[model samples]
Target chain A: MAEPVLSIRDLRKSFGALKATDGVSLDLRPGEIHALIGPNGAGKTTLIHQIAGGITPDSGEVVFLGEDIGALGVAARARRGLGRSFQISSLAPEFSALRNVMLAVQSRQGSSFRFFRPVMKDRSLTEPAMAMLERTGLAARANVPAAELSHGERRQLEIAIALALGPRAFLLDEPMAGMGPEGSRALTAFLDGLRHEAPILLVEHDMDAVFALADRISVLVYGRVIATGTVDEVRGDAEVRRAYLGERP
Target chain B: MSRERAINLLLAGLLLSVPLAALALGELFYITLATRMAILALAAVGLNFALGLGGLVSFGHAAFFGIGGYVAGIFSSHAFNQTPLFSWPFEFFGSDQMPAIWLAAMLISALIALPIGAISLRTAGVYFIMITLAFAQMIYYFAISWPAYGGEDGLSIVVRNGFPGVNTAVPLIFFLVCYVLLLAALALFALVRDSRFGAALQAGRQNETRLAAVGIAPFRIRLAAFTISAAITGLAGALLADLNRFVSPSMLSWQMSGELIVLIILGGTGRLFGPVAGAMLFVLFEFVLGGLTERWQFFLGLILLGVVLFARGGLIGVLAGKARHG
Candidate 1:
């Protein structure tokens, strides 16, 4: 009922012959987790890349907060509240988990051109960064570098960094890609609660987590949305069952 | 005390006391040698800001260095001749004032860095390195062909430039001046390294995509760092020209840039005191080896090869352990 926080319309991208993303359109409104479910090479990540301003679409419009943002670069889009998380866990590897989150906090605070004052002593940056780390269950490992963080902790740190941006919507690509069963369950619960703070356009392969958390489901097959509906409606869709669900149905 | 803190204190003490001791013993040549170390250390300190922290391997920093030297040489020459630098718009007479010349050098270097960094930061990897080197070569050739300022023969100052409250013509006084500037620049470097901007710059170096995703433009941060880096280098260049009473195309040569980088790596890249240690070692090698043989650079090359191949962290890393964050 409310205006969508993010709207992607008629997005198309191609690599020579293969149509990576072909006329894909989606919208994420406030207070909902819109799960994008697909098999391998289904163009889920490419579509996320387009929406997050990582890659330019051959033809499309990405509207954020009712403004066309197709021309903005990744940093500009981020400053406008388009938060992104990578499937491969992109982070400052040498920086401590706290410093990594503090970067996000500093970004959210406005111009980071302040040069004389020591950032480590700045409570304004550190306190909120610590809070975010605590929220993601990374408080204990705050001083450890991201390179040394456990796989699950790195994923949690990514979420904490995204949260620090005060994003209007989350473009999370495979947030649970490397997680164990327990980590997945915990993150699923965490993400389900996070949807109340901001809408999430979650691209994931973890069907169990997707089923438990998605307020609405969209099945992407070969770069096209084959079906969009409640879990039961999408689960019963014949094309999705044949193309994606397969024998599991 | 921590080994790093101990080494830091020892370095400060040695740098300060050695020159003062030379002054006490009337070893004027040693004072000059100490002054050379301080000046060269200051130059590498400027390079360290970009190469060490920002991870910008600038191969043309000698362009700024030469610019600073030229600023000092040109201004003092005009002042000595009692000629206005230009007749149009106003009588712009040159100044022998050290502070004014340093300001001019820094401003000019920063201005040059703005355009150079804007174009260079667009690229990364070897392209960035080659482009920067190419820009420095352009300046070097320009200086060579510009006959008004002595061309390839270079410009020389008739006397050392003036600094307030100090007879900069005195060898010991000049060494003290250089020493004080080196310490001030080191303090500034430490402060900048710990700032929020420094955090963003380092993060940009580590993972640019992550930096961009967090809403900080890597290009802007790097451009700022490069500009500041050049300004510091340029100031050191002016002081160096004053020390030698000359400015030449040799200062703009690519070898100077390589030597600056050598000092950084030889000390420890990204470590605060790395340049100081490297400069001391380099000058000492030049002195001792030069005394022993004519082919000293050949031996110096051997030592540099050993450091590169075997001792990855350089003299400071071996002596002081790992850098605090590193």
Candidate 2:
């Protein structure tokens, strides 16, 4: 197999007395959807935070595209093609969906420092942002402020923003977190399509969506990965079933 | 351009021509007062960088503004007396040249803001407001107690500091200097507002987590903006000192900070000319009201409180309404 696009080894982080992440390890390859699933408070979000360059791990190395990016900041990491979506919808609520995506595009294109030239007239940046919105099925909602968007549309807009950054990989934290059944099904299909474009590390709670779209799944329990495999392998694994699936039953 | 932007431009042009008209009418003192308005507006322009775009709401900007004034005053005083400020190893040098003083003022304010911003940035909401206010009070006390440069009494510039090719004492020429700087400041504000760094700054204010998700560090962005904002305000302080030929502890007081905020709120925060309009209105109100009543400031404070409590948008906001698009 080709070299893994992202590798996390023995990652650990603690908050006060709580060990949020304990020896978490995973690897993601190009063009694959890797879903991380766990019970509440399992440190899935913490692990994602460390990987996305938001929080520094107390121990372990995060190697992305052959670089040990422990010291780089969030924007520097993004400049290197690491994009993240928040578990809680995190768009500029007052900004129109189009402008929100356009900002991400603006950061990647050139210095957003051109001031004398009017921003609204800057087609060089806005055109691509609009196109990305079109790709994400948000063309109809482009003019609406993000705050006005339905929860499902905001999730789609979040994905569109990540896409506009032209990321090499996506770290999406609960993209379908607050969506209804219809929203979840629609998002799962959209994410399934994205698997062909870039490797995605999806942290999600929707079991049905995870089972439907993930190329591979890692079950995290108490900050440690108990299993990483295809649907059949993970579903059949006794440890994952006992630790997570058993509770569902 | 849109009809709205075109109208905004026309208003700016009309405002710009006022001091020139004052000069033509031979109202020299009024010209000087207009110069004062521009300089104060320039300080608000700096505050705009932090308050308007970055949403920092710094109440300590008066500290930087006062520091800039004191730097000019101390330098000119030492130059006039022809003595080293202190008997340090290298000796503290002094210059009466306004550019030299202004540059030094900018450097000092930026350096000071680094520490102030680092500490204040740790907290958000009301905590940020209190911390900034506390820092400004600390500076104000220091200035009041120092007793150097006359402290509460203020230091005066015996002669107006020299500017190249201009009679710096002449009201029209001085007003021109202030006008040019105000425009330069407005241009910088317009540029920074549209820049990528500006985008990240505003985003940081809107939703810090979202900014972090996009790989932008809110702290660093805020720090850069804070330092630049302080530097701009410091430049204004130096100009103010030159205009009045005085630097007093009052410049560092909390009241000055409140007035700066009032200027932005009155003009409309975030708009380029908001501070300018606020400054003009403030000066006009002070002049006109002071002429009409003995207790004008009481009325002015009442009006300002009304604006803050009742007015969602300042003058510009009321005039321009909402921005239709980005």
Candidate 3:
């Protein structure tokens, strides 16, 4: 088997008294969709944050492609092909959607030091940025500022920004958190299409979309992974059902 | 054209034509005034790096600015007097070259900015502003109390610092030197704004957490920007000293720092020519208003407060609207 693109071994983190991510272990292989599903405050975001190197794991390790990346910073991790989308939209709202993605592509390219000619005229940068946007279904919204994009469109733009980074893997935190049915369907399709390109560790709550898209589902409860299995296995496991699935009652 | 694009083009055109018109009309004073605008704008451009791009509202850039001026002033004074500059047992020191003085000023400013940024970046928002202000005050007081080069009265250069093949005494020639440096700094600002490093810097301002998640350290990016910021402003300081042939503690005061911030805001924070437009407008206001009323600053304060509260985007924002930052 090929080496898993990302490997987490007994990762742990705490915020004051709260154990945000407690001994969470997971592995993500290339070209797979792994959903981290948990209720609100389930430590799902914290777990992904640790893996993305946003927060340091207090114990254990988050090793990506054989390197202990938990200790590295955000840009360094991004430079190494790990791209992520924020739960909250973190784009430069004032900049156009094209410029937003261009900034990402600009970051990926070695030099942005060419100053005499305006970057806007750099077809080398803008062409690829537009192509990435087209791939994410945001080609029509390319000229609009990200602030002007709809919530769903902005979310797509976020994914587009990540894709511009040319990541081998993606950490998408709640891509469908605030979407309507149409928005959710659109995002689901986008994620489904993305899985063929690179591994995505999806943190989501919508079980219907989660079951429909995830190759594997990990049920997390109170910072610990209670169950990890095929969709049917998680749906049938009494412990997972009792801890999360059955808890709806 | 879009309203923003139209206004930017108009403003750039006007600024580009000002010196040419001044020369054509034989308004020699306008040349000096335009030079002042370019130098002050250059300093504001430096502050914009920290303020506009990095979201660091540094209120201490004047300290760097004045330090740059003093380096030029001190060296030129020693050369004019033909006196030994605190001569050590071995090293002789009386070079009054502008490049050498600017280099010294940049090094000093960067050194000062490193420690100041280290401490100020620890806090966010209002605290950052106050800490930077306090550090500038520390330097201001140091300049006031130290009796080395004229104490509170300040040092005067009898002759302007030398430049290769340039008549440093002629107002038009001097204005051209400042103009060229202004363009160079503008080019540098444009370069930094578009670079991968520039993206990281802007990201650090917008979402430090997200930036860190991508594997860049926010503290390091901010520190580098702050240092470069001081260095650029320091370059402006060197020029400003040459313009007046004097250096004073007033240049390092908090008021000067506040004026730098005002220039950025008045022009448009984050806009490329915002500082240039702002500097031009600010000098024009001072010249026109000072001629109109002795209490021009009080009116300037009233106008500034109005701009901050109502204009939101300042002159650049008012004229150009929102700019596209890459």
Candidate 4:
């Protein structure tokens, strides 16, 4: 019922002759997890990149919070509250988990040009960063370098960093990719509560988590969304089953 | 406190004490050698900002060094001849004043660094290194063929530049001034490292995509870092020209740039006093081995190979062990 926080209209991208993203359109609303599921190489990540300002669509409009943000750079888009987590854990490998979150917190606070004043003692940064780490249950490993963090912990760190941005919308590409069963259960529960903070445009493969968490499901195949509806409606759609879920005998 | 911090204090103390001991014994030559070490270390400290912290392997730092040297040489030369450097810009009379010369050197080097960094930063990895090296080589050749400033023969100042209320002509006093400046630069480096800008700059180095995703542009942070690095190295260059009372095209040479990088690697790449340690060891090798035989660089080469292969973290890493937080 609420106006969408993020809308991608008729996005298209081509790598040589093959269209990676061909006429894809989607929207994420105020407080919903709009899950985008597809077979491998279905241009799901490509579609995500297009919206996150990494790849430019040949012809499309990306509207965020009522403004056409197609022309903005990646940092500019992010500053406008478009939080994202990479498919492969993207982090400053040498920095401690706390420092990585502090960077995001620092960005939210203001200019990073504040030289001469030491950041380590700045409670303004450390406090918020510590809170995010705590929220992600990463408090104990706050001092560990991102490189040393376990794969699952790094995923949680990514989510913590995204949370630190105070995002209006989340572009989380495969948040549960390398997660174990226990970790996935914990994260699915965490993400279940996170949707109220910001609507998520989630690209994921774990159908069980998707079915459990998604308020709306969009089945994408060959860079085109075949269906978009409530989870029950999409699951019942014949074309989605044929293209992605496969037919029952 | 931390062992690294304690080791840092001891290094600073060592730098200070050795020069004072030389001053006490009237070993004026040793004082001069120490001054050279301090100046070279200061230059390497400047490079470390871009190279160590920012992960920019710039091989064209000698351009900034030469620009600073030329600034000192030109200003003092114009002052010595009692002539205006340019009458067009409202009769600009150059200065033999050390502080003013240092300002000019830093400004000029930073100015040159801006365009070079702007262009070079568009590329990454080996391309960045080669483009920077190419720029320095161009300047080196420009300095050689240009006839106005003595061409390849180089320019010489009649006397050492003057500092306020101090006899800079005195070897110990000159060394003391350089030593104080070196300490000041080190303090500033520490301060910047702990700042928010440093966090973003280091983030850019470690992972640019992550930096961008966090709403920070890596290009601007790196450019600002590269410019500041040049400014610091420029100050050291001016000090060096004053120390030797000469400025030559060799300051712009690729070999000089390589030597600056060597100084950082030999000490400890990113450690606070890495440059100081490296410079001290390098000077010791040159002095000790030069006294023994003419082929000191051959032995130096062997040692450098060992450092690169086994001592991956450089001299400070070997002594202090690995950094805890990375």
Candidate 5:
């Protein structure tokens, strides 16, 4: 019933002939996990990109924090409190985990133009960065570079980075991709608690995590949302079962 | 201690000691050669801020270097001639003072870098490299065609600029002045490398999209790095002109830009001591090889080829171990 923190309306994108995202509309409210699941090449990532300002929608509006952010760039949107993570694990591989998180913390604090003081020695930056790392269970690996982190740890670090941004809403694109069962379970529990802090527009293929964590689910098929409902309602929907949840439901 | 730290300390020691040894041994010419290495190292250090850290491979840095040289040439020329640079506004007099000239050089170079970096940072990869090179060439050709300051023949100063309490005209004193400045620039480089700005700049270099996701604009960070880098390189250029008592369009040439990059690559791209090591090696090769034969550059080319093909990390990697970052 709360006003949506992020609202995407009639978002459309095309690559020559194929409409990657056609007339897609979605809303993410506070304290809710809105999972967007679809089969391969269903334009889930394209829709997420439009919302995160990575791609310009042919005709649509992405309203964030009561402002039409369709014209903003990725950094501008991020500064305005929209957090995102890549399915392919986008991180500064050369930087230590703590430093990577510290970058996000620095962005939140104030201007990063302060050049004279050594960031490594600054307790204000390091303490908050360490706290984020601790929250992600990567406290011990804080000194390790992102490139040296395990796949699971890198995913966790991504969440830690996003959390440091103090985002009003999170547009997480497949955060649990390439994780094992144990990692997925752990991350699912973490996401369950994370939803209380900010709503998540999760685009994931891991149905177990999605079914367990999503307060509401939206089935995207061929650049369109075929169904949006609770776990039981979406499970019983014939179109979702035929198009996506086929034999499982 | 780590091998990298050990090698870095050894390099600092060698650069400092060798010059002092030359001065003590009355090898005045060797002092001059050492001074050349310091000045060249300083220039490469400036480029390293943008190229190594920010991943901005600027091929037009010679514009900053030449601008610094011209500042020295123009200011000292006016002072020597007892002529006001201009009487229209408020009668601006020229200065032979090193501090004033260094300030002018840095300010002018930063001003130039602002517009150039603003335009160049809009592109990335090879396009960024070519656009910066093209801008440098524009400045180079401009300096050549404009005949007021001697054009292709270049401007020459009768005496080197003055430094407070130091007889800069003396070879040893002048070398000392340059050495001190090089050390200061090296300190600045180290400070920036560990700063928050440096973190964002390096992150931008590694993954621009990720940097943007964290709410830091890659273009702004890179432009700041580029402008600061140009200012440092410009200061080195002024020192170089003062050392030679000459300034020419050649200082602005594309070859000069290539040489600056060579110094960084030959040493180690992102390593702190990389520029110093590369500059020393380069000057030593030029001196030793030139004494042997006129076609010494052919052998230098061969050595550079070997380093590029076999030792991708340059002399620093071979001696100091792997760079902190790939």
Candidate 6:
């Protein structure tokens, strides 16, 4: 197998008496969708936050691109090619979809300190942004503000923004939370293709998408990974079935 | 082609024409009033960069205004007294030169703003507002207690600061100088508004988390904006001190800071010519209404209330329709 692009090493986080994430470990290899699924309040989001540099773990290491990125900030980690999306759709609501992607493109280009030239006129930012929007099939709504775009469109816009960062690894937290059946199918297909460009650590509740997409599965329970294996192996595991996939499996 | 652009041009043209006309009609006092409008407008323009564009409600901008005023006052007074300001720093003598004082004012104000913004920007919302207000009050009291510059009595220059190739002491020429500088400041604000830096700053204002996800630290962007805003406000302060021939704690007072915010709100927050429009209307109210009754501020209060309740976007918004970005 290929060397893991992202490795989570015994990450632990606590809030006073309760441990949010207790010694969780996982690895995401290149060109693979590693699904992390759990029930409500199982600390899936907390683990994702620690990996994406949003929350500091009490003890652990997040290694990305062969380097320990535990001490880096959200922006620093992102600049170092760790791209992520929030579980909730996070966007600059007032900005157009194209401008939203363009901002990411600008960051990728470096030095936002340029104060004279208008950003809209700069083809370097606009062309790549448009291409990303086109890739996500959001080219028609490029001029609409993110606030005005439909919920699924905003989700696509977020992915376009993440794509413009040219990330080496993707930390996608619930990318299909609000999508309709059709939207989910389209996004599932898109994400299937996206795995080849950058390995995805997907935190999802949608089992259909997860079952169809994940090559490897990690079932999280009470801030701990109870099982990690191929989809069939995890499905047949008695502990995972009892703790999570009960009756449905 | 845009309604806002037309309104901006009209506002700029009116500012220039009125002062020129005042000189023609031998109403030299009106030229002084126009100069006040220009200087105050310049100060508000600076605040708008941080407040309107960056969404930073800085209640302590008067600190920079007073710093600029004090820099001008100290420089000119030392020159008038034939005394060096300091000896250890290569025996630095004071300068009565306008360009030199303006440069010093911008540099000093930016320096002060950098540390203030760096510390204050760590917090957000009400805490940010209160911290800024506290910093301004500290500077205000310091000016009142410090005696070298005449304490509360304030420092007065013997003559207006000198500008090469012109008589700055003449009311019309001085007003023209201020008007030109105001125009330059407006151009700079527009450039920043449309640039790449502005995109990140505005994005930061709207959603800081998203800005970080995009790989830009919102703190550094806001700090740069705050420092630049202070530099422009400081330039206006130097001009104000020169115009009044005085520099007092009044320049650093919290009231001065509040007035700057009020001007931006009254004209149109984030609009290019909002400060100019607000200053013109404010001074006009003082002139026209003050002559009729001593309680003129009561009417200003009524206008402010009306703008807040009915026209939330202020005068320019009413004239230009909704803002392109807002």
| lDDT, each prediction | 0.92, 0.86, 0.84, 0.92, 0.91, 0.93
Interface RMSD of 4: 1.3
**Model 2 interface CAPRI class:** acceptable
Q: In each prediction, how many residue pairs overlap at the backbone (N, C-alpha, C within less than 3 A)?
A: 0, 4, 11, 0, 0, 0
lDDT of 3 by residue, B99-139 (tens): 88888888988899899999999888999999999999998
Looking only at chain B, model 6 earns a TM-score of 0.98
Work out the TM-score per prediction: 0.98, 0.88, 0.89, 0.98, 0.97, 0.97
Location of the lowest summed lDDT over 10 successive residues in candidate 2 chain B: B317-326
Query: DockQ of every model listed?
Result: 0.74, 0.42, 0.33, 0.75, 0.65, 0.70
lDDT of 1 by residue, A1-249 (tens): 899999989999999999989898888989999999999999999998888788999998999999999999999999999888999999999899999999999999999898899998999999999999999999999999999999989999999999999999999999999899999999999998999999999999999999999989999988899999989999898889999998554
- Tens-digit lDDT string for candidate 4 (B1-326): 88778888888888778778987888778888999999999998999899977889999999999999999999999999888999994887789999999999999999999999999999999999999999999999999999889899999988999999999999888988998899988898888888999899888888999999999988888999999999999999999999999999999999999999999999998678889999988988999999999999999899999999999889899989975542
Candidate 5 — which residues are off by over 4 angstroms? Answer: A247-249
lDDT: worst 10-residue window of model 1 chain B: B317-326
Lowest summed lDDT window (length 10), candidate 5 chain A: A240-249
Specify the poorest-scoring 10-residue window by lDDT in model 3 chain B.
B208-217
Higher DockQ: candidate 2 or 5? 5
Query: Weakest 10 consecutive residues, lDDT, candidate 4 chain B?
Result: B317-326
Which runs in model 4 stand beyond 4 Å of their true positions?
Answer: none
DockQ pick, better of 1 and 5:
1
**Model 5: per-residue lDDT, tens digit, B245-316?**
999999999999999998898998887888999999999999999999999889988988999999988898
Cand. 6 Cα-lDDT: 0.93
Candidate 1 lDDT tens digits, B145-186: 999998999999999999989899998889889888999888
Error of 6 at B279 (Å): 2.0
lDDT of 5 by residue, A86-194 (tens): 8989999988899899999999887879888999889999999999999999999999989999999999999999999999999899999999999999999999999
